[model samples]
Target: MTNNSIAQPLEQAKSIAEKTVYSILFTISLSHLLNDMLQSLIPSIYPLVKTKYNLSFSDIGLITLTYQLTASLLQPFVGMYTDKKPKPYSLSIGMGFTLLGLMCLAVASGFYWLLLSVGLIGIGSSIFHPESSRVAHLASGGKRGLAQSIFQLGGNAGSALGPLLAALIIVRFGQGSVMWFSLFALLAIIILAYIGNWYKGAIIPKTKVEKVQVEKHPFSARRVSISLGILIVLIFSKYFYLASMTSYYTFYLIDKFHLSVQSSQIHLFIFLGAVAAGTMAGGPLGDRFGRKYIIWISILGVAPFTMMLPYANLYWTTILSMIIGLIISSAFSAILVYAQELMPGKVGMIAGLFFGFAFGMGGLGSAVLGKLADSTSINYVFHVCAYLPLIGILTAFLPNLEVKRKKIA
Candidate 1:
């Protein structure tokens, strides 16, 4: 080919690739943002719910438990189905379920109804993750780590926005406004999905499926189990950190730190924003170096900050909180990527287990930690939880199989 002709085609191909990548990231991030907003809004709205419904601590815990249990229990099925019969329909199906749950919440009155609605929302949350991870993985030509990280950053972004934005809406429109906000987010997501043509089967290879039995990785599976255990511990610690901050942060600042509500909110916003940025960075770094390294580093790096959280107040605490937020959250993107990669052949199932068991159990841990904090000092809990990540660092040295890229034909 002539030099000019070759150069023109190469540039065109580069442009197309870049556009496709941006589109993929945008769609993934938007869906995650919506999901996280729905998830996080509950904690933010707790005080209002308590006043209106006369909810007790146990009641609040139960409501939260409903969401966690449903999501955890159903994830395996969602994952397995997606891996086996992977389709673009997965995203829409998940969105449909989520919308139904959100609608239910919007109209709900009694506490039982609210619980059921949130449970449904959790189920909906469970359905999409594995399928989405698979799609992201395929889209990136099997650069699964980076893809997973980018995908998760979207959710973290939503998490960061949920409290600040939803708090504003709740103040203006009252508690029920949160439900309306979720519904709006739901509708927006559906519309965006259609507009982006996110349903295109770009991830699926045009090949026939054959029932093939392959040798199971008995050794790797054992290692994965151990790794899963390590993650569970890490999850427990992080969840405690998260729940403490989300559920009681403002109160803590006011009571313990002696800061005003407005100041606490500002610090909280900064902390969450840093977390979102850290999550985005973690994924690419994991992809470039290794997931294990990121996890270990995050554990080690964040521990001191978490420990310092109880001692300092005001400016120092805010600075410490930002540091803790970044260090602790960096693992999420890497961990999600790691979990999905663990069961390479069944991306959905792996996603389910990690998010379902590891992540879900972490929520439970948060509850326990919260109870412990109520009895003792929240500072004590933070210090205790810091050690769990250190344990994870020990397991970081375990062997991991490198993910191989499938060559395009």
Candidate 2:
């Protein structure tokens, strides 16, 4: 980097700190949509891959385990390093891996190759999430909850689209058609390049660390650690239940209702679309009220629907899934933003840790649940996962950082 450009960060940071940058927020959110849509393609195509390669449920579970672990394991380190190094162009570079993965997936001859393809995509996701999340934080102008929700909205919306797209594109045209999605990755790379340009000038350089005015939360480290643990447990409960839906909901629908793959995907799409709407509302609601209350309500509020989900008929199943999606999906944004508030200056690290933990839970959940499905039935798997959200009751133990912030002010 030139000295002239390098000297510009203080001015850029001042300019950025002045107000919320909606343009950048929307741009990064769009990139998130593209990135997650690619990642979702793997699970969305699970039925196709399972049949095409003569795979069992265990094989399907392994594919998710490989990808989720790859994505989950590296995320914290990536976030920690970038928190210090601040790589402006890394987002664009990460999308390159996704592009290659999509190309590989289109022609994957066997299950192992499919695993490799997804692993690559997982790596791309590990790199993309923490940094893109940091960009959302930087552009927030102190409205962190709103910023994160907008960012997550893109991801949730993209995830919703994946199943529908897979049904329309890959299912209709067959496995080779997966290559068509590489185009979106290519587009993301270009968009992220522009984002990188903006990011380069908008933050403090890695070569220099300025002292930041951290707002004290008036809580001890032990309390913070305890709170963090509670958050992790909540994440475990949430993602485990979600993994059941995202990974095996289609199977549940087909087996119980005797629906086509395309019809099942449409059902999944509707549920996830509700998730996207809930995600959009979550952050702003957290911003308006308190994150603690939002967290409590979001996680525990969906329990009744989940409890009833396993026993519903086709029509009630669809309605209950929508209710479950909307309520449960709202928790992540609030949880993430609350954690970020707990550790003020460690935004990237907190984001990485939470996002990583969430992914790990999801991967682990998929593997375990897949085994259960093989041994029992998809119906039984949902019946078991239905009770996981009861763990959300632990949200009560968390101290109110918002009240603390007000008092400190």
Candidate 3:
């Protein structure tokens, strides 16, 4: 072959390899938005369901437990399996489960049936998150933090939308209106299938030279393990406090401020909107500065606002809640990207572990705090949860993983 011929293909391949697959990233992000919007329906309708079923706080807690348990328990295993054997089409299949769950929820005649519906939706979430996260990683083009943040921003945006949607639809029209949301799941399935095709084709065979340059971790295995444990503690702290807000904040507003359910949901929407906004900032900042510093400021910096939350008046409560959401929401993308860096070549497993632990903590926290709220009051729940952010102090113990750029062939 002529030298010019050889150079042409080499340059073409390099150009293709080097460019970020933003189309795929945005598509996957849209799917994430759909998936989480559907998932958020469960919490968004809690007050409606509680009133419909005459549920006690403990019952409400159990419902969250059931949904969260199903979502949490299987993520790591799903992630591990897919890491070894990529499942490009599984994302669509998971959305099918969510679609069915939504249908079931629409007609749920009793609380147990409601549990079954949410459990199915949780299973769908478990299947969706880890693999979709892997898709985001593949399309990152070495900008992992930015990609993750974009991906997570969709979900947060969807989460913000759910309460507003529920207020407009379910709360006004009644539970049967939940069936309308299955359209989102169907749309997600179609998008994910298209993304799956892209994923399948995008898996170019790795060259041996490319494999050899992948960086090895500098830390001992023991140190990495300990670092992971600390991250888990941070996840626990973040999610538990979030659980109180997501699961019970409406009740707090109703009890303390005498706000209508619709009004409280709007407030929840505002907080979640702040979260979506914060999520966008974290990834790019982590990419520029370093994930550890982002993690530190995100987790610890929110403590003062959380502490003040219990004492704030209605206007101040609204302001503080948004501030809390903005600060705390930044940690996850940074933390997830950081963990992926710590355990190189285990992106799926790490994503699964952290997402799974986060769901588990939120579930457990909801259940525990539900009982606490019943025993004491909703105000007490907020007062106790305000301190959970103090666990952010553990961020000091995590060893920094330096970001190293790798050349793509």
Candidate 4:
């Protein structure tokens, strides 16, 4: 072939390769929606389970601990392993665990069985998040922040739906109705299997030594370590505050406003819906402006609303909670994308560590706050949790890695 003919084909191939794969992004996001929707059921039905089992707040907390700990502890290892050897079909296998967990949960007769069921679900989550996040990174076509946000949006939406579904199904029909959610898990497995095929095709094998060299970051070892530490602290602050809302906000509303269970759940749904809405803005804005700016605004900037939450009357409380959810929810996408950029080639490990840390914090916070609620009050828990966002001030200390890298380049 002539030079022009060969050059034309090469240019077309490069353009096709460089394009963002929105179909994969949305498909994975939908699977995330399904996966998290199933996971969210554990917390969503807490009231029903607590009542049926005659459980205390501490028991409720332990259930969360079981689920979150299993999810948290295994994620890093899974991510690390997948980094060395990409497992495209593992996502579907993870969904299978969730499907089984749902069945167990539907028939769980005692507290221990409840723990076992949730632990199984948590195992599925641990397997799903890190690898799925890596998939989002792979499909980004360089728009990493936006891709993470899109991926997160589905999760938040699923979370929002869980409370509403619990209210409609579990509250009306009882725990046996939990089995209905298995259909969601089965659907997710099929979708993830298809995504796995795409992932399999995308993998370009390389030797370990070559992979290590390609994955090297521009920052010094110390800088990357310190930055990761800061990110962890930030995550602790975010998820701890979130734990109070997700785990206890229904109780808070029922106690303070004298709203019925259904009403309380509706309010929780509204807050999470706002979270889903807010999540969409963060990634695209991070792509346009900067991740640090988005992170700073998302975490610290919501402090005023959070601080006012406990003191507000029902109407104002609803407004402030939604405001808090919207702003705070934006931080994770920026934070995840920022960490991925910090340690460039270790996308799976970074996603695993951050996601794992977030789950650990949420679980730990739930247990501690649950105990505190038993001793003090749910209102007290909210009061103390409000200060968490102040940790956002640390954002000032994070060197703008994007700018630094551009300068170095």
**TM-score of model 4 vs. true structure:** 0.95
How far off is residue 182 in model 4, in Å? 0.4
Report the poorest 10 consecutive residues by lDDT, candidate 2: 204-213
Candidate 3 local lDDT, residue 198: 84
Give one digit per residue, the lDDT tens place, for model 2 in 1-409: 8877855875565555756889999999999999988888888998998998999888898899998998888889998998888898999989999999999999999989999999999889888999999999888877888999999999999999999999999999998999999999999999999999988876753223224345456899999999999999999999999999999999999999999999999999999999988897789999999998988988898999999998899999999999998998889999999998888777778888888898889999999999999999999999999999899899999998878778877
2-87, model 4: which lDDT tens digit per residue? 99996675565445445689999999999999998888888889988888999999999899999999999999999999988899
Global Cα lDDT for candidate 4: 0.90
lDDT of 1 by residue, 1-409 (tens): 7999866755554443333365666677677777776777766665567567887655666677777777778888888776666656656666666777777766777799888887877877787676666556555544556676677777777778877875567645775565677565566457546633644534322111111222344345677777766666666656656766766676567667777544555566677877887776777888888787787787666776776667785778788878877877788667767765564466678777667774476457646665676677656665666555555556455455443222211
> What residue runs in model 2 are displaced by over 4 Å at the alpha carbon?
1-15, 205-212
The order of the candidates by lDDT, greatest first, is 3, 4, 2, 1
lDDT value, residue 32 of candidate 2:
92
Q: Give the residue spans of candidate 1 off by over 4 A.
A: 1-20, 106-110, 188-200, 206-220, 258-266, 377-383, 400-409
Cα misplacement distance, residue 90 of candidate 1 (Å): 3.2
Top model by TM-score, which number?
2
lDDT of each: 0.66, 0.89, 0.90, 0.90
Backbone clashes, each candidate: 1, 0, 0, 0
What candidate 4 gets wrong by more than 4 Å, as runs, is 1-17, 205-216
